[model samples]
Target: MFRFLTAWIRSLSIRRIPMKIIVIGATGRVGSTVVSKLAARPDIEVYAGARHPEKVPAADNVTPFHIDLHDTKDDIKESLPEAGKLIFTAGSGGKDLLQVDLNGAVKIMKAAEEKGILRFVMLSSKGSLTPDLFSGKNPSPLANYLIAKYYADEWLMNNTHLQYTILQPTALVDKPGSGKVSLGNYTTNETSIENVAEVLIGLAEHNSSVGEIIEMSTGNEPIPEAINHLS
Candidate 1:
């Protein structure tokens, strides 16, 4: 009877385990929203990664994890929680592109790979897939940023063994989300920050768009329906 009781307790522990998702850049506008959305789901536990984790809002199932993208691979890996999925929403905003955008992102990818994280979701820019579109004599000022995203995205796709989803949204706006989006190659050049966060939550929950780069813009389709259509 003691052995039976032990087995039952172990099974209960297994069944009660929640899915842990680590959101890098949780202090950012998009990342913070993602953290809040994921936290509302009882089955999900969110690890909000930020340099200043204290800024992460207090919430049940939400743990603030300190992560410095500029840190070494070992240090970054040590700081990361043991999570099943990781979302890379961190960016340098062109302040220190080489260090923060390119190298910093690659470091996290390496750490995630080493940690055996199952999935990686990257928040990229819309024109990252095609560099030539923005390059030439009179290139857009965002050329450098797009280039950084391109290489980082390439590394994620080619180098990592983890299942990955790359969301590429055009110029972000602070407007309220309509809970809708258009997925594909779009030239509208405007997407709501809230919509991006909502889509990130959908991707995390459904595990859709793996191995796919989705270009997004503001649209009339519901977020869930758009995500389902992609799947």
Candidate 2:
């Protein structure tokens, strides 16, 4: 009986933790930060695809690859897989957010569909909902970009089978992370890129379906405390 108990315990402990995830735009400002945090975990299988794969931090577990968003679906398929989580943190590196954010993402989504990858997470900016209405043109300079993001977010929302979480951050700033955050519509008076990086890692580890569009702002939320608010 003791042997039986030991065997059962071992079985439970040995359950494989799934780590086959593709971190798109892994070389970007936020993506690189996320890469650093996940690299330490032995259980995670991270594919850090970037435009410049060589730029990724050297880590044993991270598999870096060249993933240019400008590539066609066929080209993208070669770099992507059929079933796994995909976190898109890549931007066009220009205001051409329309081509990079919307079109590039759509191409990836198409590849995922062919491969049957349904789980997804995205980093989006706030207030992108206006273009879907009668105004054929986007509202602001970045409106075209916003509309593109807004529509993509909407498609994910409509699809129930796919588990998705959309994080809409305020204007991204470069500062150290204090860790506390206020999940509200108001943009933070100040927001550090480090804090944003921390939050993205938190999202990856925690699994919750609180699928509301929460806006993050700069505040005095402590680091350990902000880490806890991921749910």
Best by TM-score: 1
Candidate 1, 33-111: lDDT as tens digits: 8898887888889999999999999999999989999899899999989998988899888898888788999999999
Off by over 4 Å in 1: 1-16
Model 1 TM-score on a 0 to 1 scale: 0.91
Over 144-222, each residue of candidate 2 has an lDDT whose tens digit, in order, gives: 6677788777766674445676777777777777777755545465567777766666665556523655577777666
Show where candidate 2 strays beyond 4 Å: 1-18, 81-83, 130-141, 159-161, 222-231
What TM-score do all the candidates reach, one by one? 0.91, 0.80
For candidate 1, the clash count comes to 0
lDDT of each: 0.89, 0.72
Clash count for candidate 2 is 3
lDDT of 2: 0.72
Candidate 2 weakest lDDT stretch, 10 residues = 130-139
